[model samples]
Target: MNKKTKFITIGIIAIFSFTSLFIFSFIFFPNLQTSINSSNDNGRTLQEEVSNITIIIDYSGVKDNEIYSNITLINFNTTVYHAILNCSEIKVQDYG
Candidate 1:
């Protein structure tokens, strides 16, 4: 092949490699949230109201491979969380 043709091919290959590198190297993000469940299971009839206890373990810190998690209770159900909080090697910092 001619020197000019070979140089053009090399230049095109270099441009594509550099462009791909530039596109992937700067400020990329991990797509999470797109991974969570979107479907809902109400498990209640139309006349019966839905009952669910949504609790958030807010303000948690882990020490010695154990979690010190806080509970933020959002009650949607008529029933109560009668079960006492239990954990192994728990250091109850504070309950809000």
Candidate 2:
């Protein structure tokens, strides 16, 4: 094929591929704004309803190469739930 014809073919293919990807993402993800609006219609979010939430990290007592953290969720000045998080065998590196 000639140079002009080859360049036109490649440009058409690139445009078609980009348009197809854009259409696919919209069809699969749908609309997020509508979902957020529907949730707000029900009531306030969990954080707004809760009075206080505390997260404690105990790095002084690192055992077995693991760091521990405790999460306390309080509602109306009462402890409602507690969660313990353990990070074992995970190394954090600075990539600066």
lDDT: which candidate is best? Answer: 2
Local accuracy of candidate 2 as per-residue lDDT tens digits, 2-83: 9999999999999999998888778766673464446687543555233234444456757433333343334433323323
Query: Against the unseen true structure, what C-alpha lDDT does each candidate score?
Result: 0.46, 0.53
RMSD of each: 12.1, 9.3
- By TM-score, who's the top model here? 2
Per-residue lDDT tens digits for candidate 1, residues 1-96, read: 999999999999999999877766653533423423445344332222322334344444553343334423333322223212433333456778
Model 2 clash pairs are: none
TM-scores across all candidates? 0.28, 0.38
Candidate 2 lDDT for residue 3: 100
Worst 10 residues of 2 by lDDT: 79-88
Query: In model 2, which runs have C-alpha deviations exceeding 4 angstroms?
Result: 27-38, 41-73, 76-96
